[model samples]
Target: MKLTNKITIIALAAIAAGSFLALAQTPANNNIVDEIVWVVGDEAVFRSDIEEELQQLRAEGSALPPNPYCVIPEQLAVQKLYLHQAKMDTIEAPEGQLNNQVERRLDYMEAGLGSREKVEQYFHKSYAALRNQLREVMRTQYIIGQVQENLTKDVKATPSLVKKYFAAMPEDSIPYVPLQVETQIIMVYPQVPQSEIDAIKDRLRDISERVNNGESEFATQAIMYSEDGSAMQGGELGYHGRADWVPEFSNVAFQLSDPKKVSRIVETEYGYHIIQLIDKRGEQVNVRHILLRPHVSSADLEKARLNLDSLRNEIVKGKFTFDEAARYASHDKDTRNNRGVMMNQKTGSSRFEMQDLPPEVATVVEKMQPGDISQAFVMKDPKRNQDVVAVVRLTSRTPGHRANLAEDYNQIKEMYLAARKQEVIDEWVEQKIKNTYTRIEESWGNCDFRYKGWKK
Candidate 1:
């Protein structure tokens, strides 16, 4: 979800520069002309590029990988290889997604840096100019990433291969596995009574009418009445596409061509909203909205709890398995189809460290053992920010220890697959270097590189 799209933007904080605008000058002295550090095919890796990347890494608190001047340039050179291939293949990044990503990135940077003016000052460019540069960078990044995915998406490791990979690893080099637990849950959102929903909808309809009649500015109304986090910014969701928003909301939002017209009530998992389109450019649309979630009455919440309690009792009495109940009854879209197993978003693993678990889940699970089903309890849903009743079962638990094939086969399989993928990429690079025109300045060729064929 682009709700935390800052993580993606923060990743680019180490991508070196704002774009070519910031890359036009070297660090420490803007007067010095940039020189080519290396040339891969038709693309030139400039000295300023290396310096900018190094500066960005330092700014992001990343440790330099021994002789950053050489390493950073090499990294840029490799990126150019993919970029070149992408161009040849005519890989086009969707403009709307690219613009939306750039907009979100800039929004995040502005908030983190304090203000839009500070962001402009930091980048040494106007907001529009900076956005243009970021859009191009994002486009290139998307193409490069797509190229890499194309190359490695089909690669897979077998159980035997994983076992062999694990056996070959030195005991001293084996990674320490943190204590992790896999959890499964059955969720039931507390039902908002129809009366409450109708009341909120009525209120929203009135607000929309008022805005339509010029009784209030859309942003002013948003700030005054919207419940979303963006209410502080007048419910301005910068610019985004269908991918970043709920389908129902996005459908109604994109259908509005006139900026002044407010959309009727739109219902989504989060709540009810009436959106006013600020502007639309290509696939990107900017909008301000007022969101009003129907309050779940105590009776409704108790109803949800009782429902879950009945389901829990049925599972305990062996009427049906927890997995079956979760699939048939759980309201969580993310885990329902997966047999109730919850995935840790950061690690992309079913297992989660205690600290990484949702606070409510963590607090309850701490007192339970493996195979223990927790009692139905009310907790705020992290995504929707609404009260939900749920019952969780600790599926599996592993103590902190050195990683081994028996208990951690999937992790070993991933490591093996990654190592193999790297080898494949290195081989591809070695061959591509030979076929493509390549030259490195002698001064830049002194450091040890992962691929030595570039020197050829």
Candidate 2:
């Protein structure tokens, strides 16, 4: 049987902290007791731990199993086994990856909750404390993942094995494929007037001049004027490889030989930037930059829409095929050369589920039929951080259907391989529980568990 879904570390930590605070505030005569529920090897699971997990589940609106008391401890125990194995095998989570994950998770939480203060208030912990707890939890998760990968590294589902796995499956167990669509798009960015372009450049030049003349610090100017997210951090983009930055930015950033000198204004897709060298390590550079983007007026947007509309009219009148127009006229570098076919980044495929398409594209495509071309519509270009006009063609649509060997061979093969890996893990867990020292509180032992040998 499958184990419980992974619990969110933030939610668990919050619940645990609230529980402890509640206990601390209770009268001395209170009867509430928290005690050890189970011991797996050298690790102990507490009653409070189980309650925290339960509270987290409730908070997240997840339905509990028949007896979560029995289920949760087993899940925790299984995780401990993987972590213990990871320790014994000397497996380590890369520090860089760990830090990046922690920061990203914290950023997501802060964004959702409105601010760092709100997150800390809800969790009843300081920002640093929450970060520390998350880091430890993320590290444990990473190590456990490494251990599992090591165990199933050699397990492969060949074509014959995949066919056998599919053949033996019950009819009701077959997976259903969702309706998917393939679309082609031609995107044209609104042209910023030359006056606006010159204005942005002039401002950057003034800022650069001030910094060079010692009238102001680069970091100060960046914090006050830069439009990029790094502005809050004084525009410091930490040490990164040359490949980390766009070609134009990197070319100028690497050429800065003097720390005090600011580079000439550099133009990139995001905007215009002026860079100051901070430091350099073997093949890596650290620089600070201020970015300014030219504003696109309503007139510019209307012009772009009309241009795209004219192009659409040409395609409809048989002046040229949609593919030809996309290849020669589209401004989006990513899809222009590929004949404007939009790829699903999540699946690395040409097909997209309705929800997976961009909001503007989805809105237009939902009302369209195969071979229908949409009118020019405006959408945000996330890469360049600007508004652009686009027209799309519904290339094809596949209706939802049951998975079959003919049309969904790759999907079936992946499912079979994943099942095989989980089977290997389950077998390993069964053996590990037998070999490890485990003790369960008698009061908590009166329920069913999917794995054997845990009662002792």
Candidate 3:
């Protein structure tokens, strides 16, 4: 999920610079400086590959050490170990999958590299030729991932092991567990009464009628009436797949075949829509629409607020427990099952690192103490189209600290398991490098490696 360049560097994904015929000038052991840094069976690790990634890193403003060449070799060694294992285990992607992924990624890389022509010019090849080279490299990476996943499939965690793992970590080496608080609230969307919905629908039907009657152009009417962001641009949302859009909108949009005909009012969470499908291909559709959300009734807000006040009074009087109240009364489904214990959706754990919590929830939690409940307040729910009133529940709070076995067993166990897994993988790689066919280029004859037997 993270496209961050820093995370990519820290992961040490594929380490090795491609060693080419025209790389660093070194004619030490070999008469010709061109040498293979290491070989895995028939495949070789060159200085070029690592150098490219390092150059990419540097361009991204990474502060790199002067010793990237050394670090890259080890990374390349690990990647080769994985690559070798992948071939052995038949972890290979079909030509078609690699082709598709390469094509999709190429689009992004092309944009990043500036343009299609620019990219082709830099690589000194036509688009098709460049794609073929990228495909081969991508296929190797894909196979390596499959091999690693296969090896790690059986890794399991246990409570006792998790505890011991945390205990073994040095105090400073342990990650600081962030402060978190849990709470939940019930939200009632700002009210749009039936009459208002019907009025908006009627107005949309009139627009559709005008377009159908040929009295007015669809784009012009849309410019004057459409409420969505694309209104100014003639209501063109461009071509999009069904999966990319909200279900209700896509279902109707994708179904429309006639360009001249205007569709019925489509109701999505965004609002009511009257759409004109411009075109379609298989599961993809292009459409333009006018959206209208009904105005919220003040009476609806009062009704919700009055109900919340009654609920609050009941909680104060101990007539109903918070859990029971949330179960029977809360409208938000995510927390309703957990008795309204509002954990972050992005992180499954109940605790939210201060940075990880949603802004609205964080603001509420920041000003409150443990066990305090906020007065009913209205806030906009990002998922919904309207404002809603809900009370905040400030449960337990934990501050940042060095992880301990008692307070942070799960995290410790994860870290311990990860460390153990890394050690096991390292041992496996060491054995593989020793047993596999390997030859360091004469130019790299003097550089030290963790596995000394690789030279033979």
Best candidate per TM-score, number? Answer: 1
Off by over 4 Å in 2: 1-34, 110-122, 205-266, 274-291, 309-324
**Better model by lDDT, 1 or 2?**
2
Q: Flag clash pairs in model 1.
A: none
lDDT of each: 0.79, 0.81, 0.67
Clash pairs, candidate 2, are none
State TM-scores per candidate. 0.85, 0.79, 0.70
TM-score quality measure for candidate 1:
0.85
The CA lDDT at 369 in model 2 is 94
Model 3 backbone overlap count: 14
Which residue ranges in model 1 land beyond 4 Å of their true spot?
1-28, 110-118, 193-195, 297-314, 318-321, 327-329, 337-339, 347-349
Tens-digit per-residue lDDT, 143-249, candidate 3: 77677666666777788777666667577787877676666665556556889988998899889999999998887887798777667656766556667678898
Runs of candidate 3 with Cα error greater than 4 angstroms are 1-37, 92-143, 199-265, 270-303, 448-453
| lDDT (Cα, tens digit) per residue for candidate 2, span 122-217 | 666788877777677777778888999999999998899999999999999999899889999999988888999999999998998999999999
Q: What is the lDDT of residue 20 in candidate 2?
A: 28
